[model samples]
Target: MNDLHQKELLLKSILENTRAQTQAIEDDELELLETLITRREGIIRQVDKLDQEMARTTPGTSKEPTGPIKELLRQIITIDDANQELMEKSVQDMGKEVEAVKEELRTIRERRRQGESYVPEYGDYREEGVFFDTRE
Candidate 1:
């Protein structure tokens, strides 16, 4: 296969894998998601290099790719968009959870402060003197 075709295939594969990884976010598989994100970043770098190579090889007038390559490019764009949305939603959800935790902490602190100031109705008593007897 030609280099362009190979690059297209690789890009499509990476995009597909990234889409799959985004699904893992819903499952709460954080470790796997982190690994996948790292892999996706590496693949994105590869895609960028390939894009640069294609740009260098192609004529300036023919700015757009044609045929199967074009179609694959469109698919990659759609998948990437979906993955971006998913990631954004995940971040928003995490932000909400963090806010909830902060509010809960604030409530706990307020209650602790209130408790500290509270005093029972009964008065406190103190011993004023101590005596020791040596007779047996």
Candidate 2:
């Protein structure tokens, strides 16, 4: 197989994995997402290895990507951008939740502090104990 064709196949595989990753993200399938990302990484490593071999064989030659490869890369980059945006939104939502929890805790502490500030009437304890008998 031609090296370019091999690279194309690898890139297509990466792109397919990337699409699956997007679906995993949307569905909140964390385990599947992790697996997809790992697979993509392995595919990417293969692509890099292929490129290195090609470079070694064709020294000093500019190996600009052909049209279809360029298009695949473009799509991959665009989807990756969307994925980044989704993750950022998730982070922001979680941040808001954390702040709300902190606020609730602060309110509870303040209410508790106020409730603790009251002193019981001194007369209340007097009934529980007998004064020295004034009358025989």
- Give the lDDT of residue 37 in candidate 1: 78
The global Cα lDDT (0 to 1) of model 1 is 0.79
Scored by TM-score, the top model is: 2
User: TM-scores, in order shown?
Assistant: 0.67, 0.74
The TM-score obtained by model 2 is 0.74
Model 1: per-residue Cα lDDT at residue 7: 73
Residue-wise C-alpha lDDT for candidate 2, range 43-128, written one tens digit per residue: 99999999999999888866888789899999999998998888788678889999999999999999988876785645346456
Looking at candidate 2, what is the lDDT of residue 126? 42
Query: What is the per-residue lDDT of model 1 for residues 1-136, given as tens digits with 9 covering 90 to 100?
Result: 6767777777777767777776787687889888887887888788778778777887573657788778877877787787778879888999999999999999999998898678553656655887889899
Superposed model 2: Cα runs more than 4 Å off: 28-32, 58-61, 118-136
